[model samples]
Target: MAKPQPTDAQTDAEPENTEAAESEARDPAQALADIEAAFDAERAEMRDRLMRALAELENTRKRAEKDRREAAIYGGSKLARDLLPVFDNLNRALNAADDQTRAAAKGLVEGVELTHRELLAVLGRHGVERVSPKPGDQFDPHLHEAMFEAPVPQYAAGQIIQVMTDGFRLHDQLLRPAQVGVSSTPSG
Candidate 1:
């Protein structure tokens, strides 16, 4: 038997089908490389997201730790300030004791002094400090409140002439400003 010759329509259709098949066919290595490229892109995206999440978690943890430390340091500031009057009274009682009274009741005076010292020690242990500005010290508005102004020959302008009541601080925060008398130049 003889092979049949192709018609014009059949010839045209054969080339189109062969082109489609050629376009669809790919070598094994090229296909594998394309698949690897896609996988790598997905992995990189996942890694970026994970890194961002980890950074956010670390920031949150640091903020929480700082807040906890601040709370611990300043938690009792109000109560500490409220109890300052008690400290003042103790000092007043000791100061009011005259020589006759002290000599008459030596043990009582000693006991009061001891109690005052112990209370001060306790306050110091809790980071509360007495701000006692001596005479002629420079007046600091931030730590001292000027109740009055005086003029004298021995003191300069803006000097602390007297500290009426001691101030207090709790861990670098001032609970109360020291009541003071500031000195000025003698009035001409």
Candidate 2:
């Protein structure tokens, strides 16, 4: 009997079977690589989100701290401003008193002076300071408010001719601007 001949279907099926086996053999390595890539992508996304959250938290904390500091520094501003007129009145009384009357009222005058000094000292300790501009000094719009312009030949234009009210500062911030008179040259 002659050996059985291979059929056309069997011949075609043999190469296809071998190719499928080879593909199956590589599947585990491919799956592992895919899983590692997926894990890396997930980790990167999580890290980015964490960094963003941290930055936002830091910004919020800094803003809150700044607000607290400002509140503490300027909380008494209204009360302090209200008390300034009292100080002005006290000074005016002292200035108007005659020499003999001042001597006779020495104890009362000393008490007022002491009170004024104590008030100033307390204000200084809390970062309050006087802004006393001298005549002929260059007028600063940030620290001085011009109430009137005086024509003075002795001073240059825009110079401070007189201070109507002394100014005060709380730290580097202006609490009140000095009421001042500025100089202007007369027209030729």
Candidate 3:
């Protein structure tokens, strides 16, 4: 068979196609470098995700440990609160006893005093402490409940003139507020 003569368009396109084929043919080292770059990028992305997951896990563990410690520290708060009324009654009984009555029942009074002291010691050991604000001390609204206001010559306004009931605290937290009377008017 005889070869056909090339058209002008076909001749023109041939060189461009050859150039494209030559460009597509890459160096082996360059090809390997390209592959390594892609693999490195993928590895770096996976490592970042793994690091984030580990950080989140550590944070969760720390949070859980804090919660457990708080639970252990404040676990007996409710029981301690419930026992306050009993302590108050004991104090009231001691206050109600007349001098003659106390003398007559000295042994009984002494027993009650000892019991009160022991209970207080146990409570103190567990971080529970008494909040007894003395008369003429400055009244704190956070720790005291003002049952009534009265004018008194001895105390300035906003001063505690009387404490009706002693308060109690568990650590820095107020278990009960002190019942108190505040001086309403300033002393002359």
Candidate 4:
């Protein structure tokens, strides 16, 4: 008679089964405690992984919301900047008109004036505002750019002496700082 060979699966599992049976037989309560401890360790590891995933998901949500808000606020900034030169050219034309020119071409001047007003109105609707600082006013580096510094007797040092062009602001952001000359005279 030929003896049947033990199957590979049965051979591999025999040692682990024997060890468990021996442990259980030695002290049943201790074996039960060991099983409970292993389950607890696995449960803790799974709980830690779930908590980390939840935290990452929350951070991604907050970052997405912030990006959406910034896009809404500053999305048109490039177009706004491009249109600034157009506004400056229009203003220059109006400024160059003297009393003689105005009298000679009153209708033409009026048309240009109307167009300029309309342009300003359109810009205002989109949150652009002029930052025209006058001479003798305090210079604000945030809103005005110092193109030159000179000792002017009429104004104290740090005061704006002249404004070459008006600045523009869109919401809290400055599109162009007012081109200015700050006084450099020593204050008494």
lDDT of 1 by residue, 1-188 (tens): 99999999999999989876775584666778889999999999999999999999999999999999988999888888988998899889988999999999999999999999998898899899999999899999989999999897799999999888999999899999999999987897
lDDT of each: 0.92, 0.86, 0.90, 0.91
- Against the true structure, candidate 2 reaches a TM-score of 0.74
Per lDDT, what order, best first?
1, 4, 3, 2
Question: Comparing candidate 2 with candidate 3, which one achieves the higher lDDT?
Answer: 3
- My TM-score estimates for the predictions, one after another, are 0.71, 0.74, 0.76, 0.82
Candidate 3 lDDT, 1-188, residue by residue in tens:
99999899999999999886775674666778889999999999999999999999999999999999887888778988998888898898889889998999999998888888887888888888899999989999999999999999878899999999999999988999999999989645
Go through the candidates in order and give the C-alpha RMSD of each one to the true structure: 5.1, 5.9, 4.5, 5.4
Ranking by TM-score: 4, 3, 2, 1
Backbone collisions counted per model? 0, 0, 0, 0
Model 2: per-residue Cα lDDT over 11-95, one tens digit each: 9998999888887785978878888999999999999999999999999999999999998998778777776777677767767
Q: Which ten residues in a row have the lowest lDDT in candidate 3?
A: 20-29
